[model samples]
Target: MKLTALKTMAATVALGVSMAGAAFAADLRIAYTGYSTDNTFWIGVAKAAAARADEMGVELLDLTASSPDAAAQKDAVDRAINMGVDGIIIGSVDNRAFDASLDSAKRKGIPVVAVDTGIEHDHVSSLVQTDNLAAATIAGGYIVDQLDAGTVLILGGSAGHQTGNARRDGVKNAAEAAGHEVIFQICDWQDACAYETTVNFLQSNPDIKAIFSAWDPGALAAVSAASELGKLEDLVIVGFDGNPANLVSIEAGEQAATIKQDNTRMGAEAVSNLIGLIKGESVPAFTPIDGILITSDNVAEFK
Candidate 1:
């Protein structure tokens, strides 16, 4: 009887040790959603996140919508929830569209993190984003200073995107407050639309001295449009998102400036925060990353 009891006690101890090891080796599943996979910015974020997940031995599944559409992004989040991921990172297409989905995730005890664009839902455990408004304000101030109160054309993304509206409002408020006339155009974050809109604006408003685009691709398109219209030299084009193409444009004196957001860092930080939450750790609800202004004066530093 004593021998049998000793064997049972030893088996219980061994089983407990095995269970602890399994818990430690459990894979963390993550789901990510964003606008489109084509943009260099989003691509960098995805690559960085994937690399980190691999290093940590975590399972990551990326989901991208046809475009920056709210409904599509929400569907992706819903799918992640149904699949029972440990955590989720959302690049919200529209800030308000993911409230219900996020709420559902929270109900299921899964943590949600927002990257690039923030969501309005209270369930979002954390947000990692750049200071977009501050960057736009800098761009606006630079344009006003260079043009000396001339007409400034503002090219923005889709109508309802929070990032788009924030940037547009920042530039418009700054320029208008400084006694400069602001003309706003919506390109829906499409390069082709930006190109066409820029061409039409240039033809109609010959006196427009500067153009501020919300992203590098749109700015590059505007630069091409200006060149086609023989107004490249006369137009001062500023943009956000310090993409490699925009940096090249800055070096070539084609674009006046761009705002640099550390997309890789943002992605890595989002993953780290979500992992912490999965482990039942505390995380901040919002994490605002800084932005740097890139121009010919300091473009070499970034390059």
Candidate 2:
């Protein structure tokens, strides 16, 4: 009986040591899947979030879709699940394409926080993004004031994506309500695609008075296309996401304006929310970061 007690005490000490080692080594392992790093906006996000993760002493697993590819994003989710992540924070490629993977994570009791886009699943515990509808409304209102009922070329992201669709609908709805016709040219938010599409559309509709891209890169592409045609001065070109490149264009009188999203803050806040969730704290269902309009009048401020 003394030998049995001794053996039991040894086993208990071993278990306690093992548990303490695990607690000391890895408090949590969280994963983050971002949008295309090709966009400088997302790059800013990644850098800021990584800094926050480091400060929190948490291991951040970074995964990003190259450029709004659902398959790639889904693969990333699978990898995160397979890694047994404590939680996942994702800026979904399409927001609607991760149903299966998210469902799998849910079954495994892994929580998810969405950033920059809304996934239509109850599994997502929190969402952090700009007020896209309000931002796009501002864009539309600006366009309405700048042009007098001329067709506005709506160059932007994939129409199926929630953030893309929200921006599109917000602008389209507002622009249409003001008696302006909107023709959507979805380009998956690719700069080259925006350039080519703008060139073709302008060739066919030289009367187009304004161009509004949902993101700044597309705006930059539109500016280049118009400048190449010696029509930069004639078009009212506006974009979202106040990238420095877009600000430079606005300064150069190529693009007219852009909306600046606080992407860095959004990224940091996502990490904060994830950490809070892990600590058994209730997080808000939605978190919003502010955005601003960057034109020649205020571009210098952002710069």
Candidate 3:
């Protein structure tokens, strides 16, 4: 009877431990979304975020919009809500179009973490991205240094897009304040559109000395356009977002310079903060990642 009692107690203890282990084994599910993957910037963000999610053993459901459409991202939020994701990480398409779905997510007790482009919603638990204005100010100042007295064209993203606008303001403010003539055009963040704009603008405004593309892909477009026009060496081309190709272009003498935003770090930090928030830890409302100005001088390091 004593042996039987001991055996029964051991069995009961094992059952309790097994039940506790089962309860702890439920893994977290995260839904990751981005506005566009057309640019290398977002591509880097996705890759880094995925790697971090894997490291954390979290199941990440990735989604993205092909274009800068708010509806797509909002729909993604809804889907994530329906799927009952534990948390959300998103790079918004626009600042204002996500509040409704985000609010819905809040209603379901799911926290949202915004990365890259910010959504102007109070419900976002945290934000991770580079300081756009300062980065672009550096790029714009570089452009001004290259040009003495000729018109400069700025290839910008969506009109009124907060991130793009900050970059635009930075470059324009620095360049104009330095006495360089500046003109602007919107490309909606499309590389092809930037290429066409550069080609067309250069034809009519051949005296333009330099171009500042808000993103690195747009800078590549400017490079292609200038090379085709046989004026590549004559014009100073500066791009934002130090993508791999941009670093290559800087090293290969195809492009002038770029503001290298640590996109991988941004994504990784987003995941980190989201996990912290899920664990009921305190995190900052806004997290800013610094950028590096990449020129031939330091392109080797980044490469």
Q: Report the C-alpha lDDT of model 1 over 1-303, residue by residue, as the tens digit.
A: 999999999999999998774565366788988766888899888888888777767788999875667688888999999999999998776777877887799899999998988777778879889878887888887887787657899898877777888789888998899988899988888899889989998999887899999988999999999999999999889988889999999999999999998999888888888888888889877778888889899999998
Quote each prediction's TM-score: 0.89, 0.89, 0.89
Model 1 alpha-carbon miss at residue 18, Å: 14
Q: Can you write out model 2's per-residue Cα lDDT over 129-181, one digit (the tens) per residue? A: 99999988888888888987688899878868888888887788888999888
Question: lDDT of each structure?
Answer: 0.86, 0.87, 0.87
Q: The CA-based lDDT of model 2 is what?
A: 0.87
Q: What TM-score does candidate 2 get on C-alpha atoms?
A: 0.89
Instruction: Please give, for residues 101-122, the per-residue lDDT of candidate 3 as tens digits.
Output: 8889888889889997777777
Cα deviation of 293, candidate 2, in Å: 0.6
Least accurate 10 contiguous residues by lDDT in model 3: 18-27
Total clashing residue pairs per candidate? 0, 0, 0
lDDT of 3 at 58: 74
Q: State residue 129's C-alpha deviation in candidate 1, in Å.
A: 0.4
RMSD of each: 5.1, 6.7, 4.9
